[model samples]
Target: MSMATYIGLNFSVKLNEDYTEDEVEIDYVFSSEEDRNVVKQKHFTTPYIYEVFEKDEPIWRMNEDQKIHSPHNYEKSKKTFLYLCHLLKELLPKGDYCEVYICWLGEEVEECEGELKFNLNNLQIEAIDIYEKYFIRIEN
Candidate 1:
């Protein structure tokens, strides 16, 4: 048996802000939890982000030459967005915008099981890169 659910998500990442000071801010927004685990897991990385700042910055930070190290924690849904960020860093220069629009949801396919594809402005990145994409559960 196979099933799939389309969930709506919008992610906007601004890299190397051109403001008076250099800053990186990621905006996360999602609606509803198709199931309970989603709610418990917390779709957004806002909490973990703060934790990184308060506790440690090594997980995701830039060095002297503007290089990012270990910027992702391998969260399913969030992976698509982080993948967007990792790619945007390469194409976009300082103060560039990376907007990811997630529109497709797949499940139980092939031997891999699940996969996710997202639109990164003009570019597209799939979760198959890490094979830890988002998967949902449906209860009757």
Candidate 2:
């Protein structure tokens, strides 16, 4: 018998304002297959921070909060969400039902997308379509 599993996908994006030197970060979690797929297709933006070292070394890094950008305003964030969903679908077994958890970290409080009461049925179907086109199934 196949074992039941819960899958989690974490996505983040960061945006730095060139003029203000301010940054915006965003994160999203897909708990249900339906929500996951919906989030994947949606368009959002990603924010990034650049740091200069003493030796003139330039480094780009994301915050520990794993915040990307505002999903309500950006398109890249949506793209990142989609990519995450793809990864989750590929990693999970086909026969087992899965519960996903998503967490989005911002400058302040983290925002959540899906709830345990809701399942990602539609999102899972979309993920499967993507998997068929991009992922190759392996036999154990």
Candidate 3:
């Protein structure tokens, strides 16, 4: 069976000064799928903000947090969540706060929620409260 997990990043952008909008992408028709598929397919893309170290172990690996999966997969899931935390830290502004919400809703695991607050001032993860329908394995 395939594993699926939802990964999302939410933050705000505040401009210091007003500026006019630049050129936008004009709507165009594509003759074929290949013609429209200009962007490369990737697990996730964050230009200069963050980079994925391991191609085999993307953040989506956290989907293995199910009872059907082996302990090894679970271990990888744990590690991926750490990477997610680091990614969130890197994406947040120095003085801004971002809410991190990751969920693993597998058959056996049901729904596992990880909520956190990134403390930009100290470069530390301040609040971490994870709730799981099954037994929790990932550490804070």
Q: List the residue pairs that clash in candidate 3.
A: none
TM-score on alpha carbons, each prediction: 0.20, 0.26, 0.31
What TM-score number comes out for model 2? 0.26
Please provide, for model 1 over 22-125, each residue's C-alpha lDDT reduced to its tens digit, 9 standing for 90 to 100. 12233222222232124223332111211001111221122112222333432322433344345445544544332121222222122333433333343333
CA deviation > 4 Å runs, candidate 2: 1-73, 97-121, 124-140
Candidate 3 per-residue lDDT over residues 109-132, each given as its tens digit: 233333333343343321232333
| Candidate 2 residue-wise lDDT, 1-140, digit = tens | 21111122232224233333212211222133444343233311212111111111101111112233432322333344344345434543554333322222121122333232212234532222111011112111
Q: Largest lDDT belongs to which candidate?
A: 3
lDDT of 2 at 48: 18
Per-candidate clash tally = 0, 28, 0
Q: Write down the TM-score for model 3.
A: 0.31
lDDT (Cα, 0-100) at 26 in candidate 3: 13
